[model samples]
Target chain A: MPEELPPLGDKVYLDSAAAVADIPDGAVILLGGFGGVGVPENLLAAMADHPARELTIVTNHAGFGERGLAVLFRQGKVRKLICTYAFHKSAFVFREIYMAGKIELEQIPQGTMAERIRAAGAGIPAFYTPTGVGTQAAEGKESRGFGGREALLEHALPGDIAIIKAHKADRLGNLVYRGTAANFNPVMAAAAPLTIAEVEAVVEPGEIAPEAVHTPSIYVNRVVLGENLELRSEA
Target chain B: MNSDPKLEAAALTPGDIARRIAREIPPGAAVNLGIGVPTRVANHVEPGRGVMFMAENGILGAGPRPAPGEEDWDLINASREPVTAVPGASLFGHADSFAMIRGGHVDIAVLGALQVSARGDLANWTVPGAGKGGIGGAMDLATGARQVFATMTHLMKDGGLKLLEECSYPLTASGVVGKLFTDIAFIEFTEEGPLLREVAAGLTAEDIQRVSEPRLLVAGTIGTLTREPEAAEPGA
Candidate 1:
């Protein structure tokens, strides 16, 4: 007789707080967003109240106004930031903390940062590109010649956890994003060991067409219903 | 401001520079407009030209800024300003968006520059004394685009020449700029040197040479640069 298999449990959680409850201190978090879009605002709010400290966050921008990542920075929960753009006019919180030398920052080119995270998800160790050759961005990095041009070696960037926002998700954790809001969520979803997604709505598994899914359920570990935050374009 | 008649007449407005650059773009070319003055190029491109605007933050075929109360937070440009998507537009993740840029699929990149060398070296990201500024996609766009153009003022506020023999600011990319459009002149970088192509209506070649640090080579008759009148606002 064949061995009996255990039943599979649904990935849905009641709220954002419960989804992010297990995040420990000193965790490397890959945050999915580009400016104002694709940010997991509800999950970030929950993290602000959580006791986790000393987090190293990887994202596109540091923070916009006084919400989202800015709130976490104001609370002293973030220890380091790996991002492309760090100092916008409204990102006063990150700028103040960084100027005081209270936090660490590693600035990467926008394209290179995206590729590094994508490489981690694709299981590639490292790759070479000609984006930052002969500039300060190439300092302390290995170089080689290819096709009569020089390229720099960039390594894959992995994270301990990935927190992302999606437009919709199935109970099986399949995700779909709306418009430009898909910016960094798909890449971050694949680069982390534990991926928690905050979605506006949850549906049955068959509700989402397989071909229309932006992120497959295999990469997502959990999904929770998030409050619909007001959408503004200033950030 | 104490300004000479010749100096005042030679100056072209920011709109002139943007419209001049827009006329140079061929039909059906994919263009990436950098922040600042270059962003205005999109407003001048005639409709139905099939020109596509690529925003580095994962948008292709980006349209004009939306009217008030019609802005969608999910739809924005690289500058994080709310914009509309043109017909047949497509959206993707950051990885694929940058792949389109770094892979050299973009035909033209129009960027604003702080300083540009005669040899086409570009330096615009950060100044020497200024604190760390974001690189964004400038380096990738500079190195990957088939042709790079820079739009900037001809002189600094202190009356210093911005077209230099060598850039004082940090280099965004070396020998990437092919064409330059300034408030006073339009020039092209050739293998020999920079060739003066056009000048403002009241300025002569000698007048341009006075402000430019590097020697400008003039061949044939120089054309006068002029801006077309503004088009009527849509839905007005």
Candidate 2:
């Protein structure tokens, strides 16, 4: 912690290394991304070199190729993965590790995964949803019939911290996302005890319109620039 | 998309099965298409129709794939394939999108199948004990949609019937499939049991029966299935 803060409503700007320094080993991390979009790239790069080990990562998909969470998996940082899709065409690393019994996996239906995270943010302990009633996803869980159909009991999925990406941020840490990059970032920010956001640019408060902010400043603890934002491909 | 080009020449292709299912999509209905054979339904939806395409990955009003070299990584589908969105498109998070589905906002969901039981129980996400078995979103879509339509080949590659008396594989959902469109026939799951609605051209009702383990009920108005849009009567 620093001795003196910059000013009221000014989020502490940290370099990638300092931003990730507090995340301890075996932390339950909520990662914001869908496919390759909206991934906290620089933070993940920092994590590649960081000493945090045996992490439990919760995200939408098992990342493909050699980037994002796949890199974390490759570095042997992930102990367990809780996600929606464990198998996809781009899954090179997870397939090898998971099949070899080197890692643990808990596959939740996509909607159920999102709702569980959102439920944590909303301070709800549990809710009944019709997502995985009769499937393997509902195994060993309590279920009841509602309106002549089964609804599975799902609990909240709170996390120690959320590392997310956004397009822009204000000094107050209000965020704005570009395109479909908005998928999990907003919800994950609210679901965690601490939230670190990676942004393309951080401007003064008045620069971003009030209503345009996708994630309010209160949910964010720190902000880091992704560095060389222009080179980041939107395609 | 056909993953196997060698099987493309095989009759009752995935595309052909998709076309048959596309005709059942009522105009102005909000529809969700699962990955695999059902994903091709977006290509067959008639333009300017009021149909709203929903993807569980948080997109509504999703359109067909963009022309070559015009891909937008930010605008991809649930399958992670680059796609375009129709006018009035809406982007949301996974929770909201599935809320639309489970809350009964979506009118129809078309899915691929490994096995559809006589009672409409569906198993598509896995081959029993396969290392790659993962359910994804099929369980949600199966239980959520107002109406569910399954599209796939009638038989497995080894000449085994996919329409069965009971699902031997793990089920994605139970008693939810309303209809099934296959390469060889169109079948409906009713309170009574599996009803054979229509058979493909040059194929007899007995041909489908020979492969089916469940007793199939032939529809009173059963006819040969056709691809020409005009061949289907308006709202037939």
Give the TM-scores of the predictions, in the order they appear.
0.94, 0.91
- Whole-model lDDT values for every prediction: 0.87, 0.82
lDDT of 1 by residue, A111-210 (tens): 9999999999999999999988877789999999998999999999999999999999998899999878988899999999999999988888789999
- lDDT score of model 2? 0.82
Worst 10 residues of 1 chain B by lDDT: B227-236
lDDT of 1 by residue, B134-236 (tens): 7778888998888999988888876788899988888888888999999889999999999999998878899889888899999598999975444531221
Report the C-alpha lDDT of model 2 over A1-235, residue by residue, as the tens digit.
2478666867756688888888999999999887777788888888898999999999887877777678889888999999887887677788888888878999888778888999999999999988777778788999999888778899999999999988899878899987677778888999998999999888888899998888899999999888643212322
lDDT string, candidate 2, B185-227, tens digits: 8999999999999987667788778778899999888877754
How many pairs of residues collide in each model?
0, 0
Instruction: Locate the minimum summed-lDDT window of 10 residues in model 1 chain A.
Output: A1-10
**Each model's DockQ score:** 0.69, 0.57
Candidate 1 lDDT at B222 equals 95
Looking at model 2, residue B131 earns an lDDT score of 61
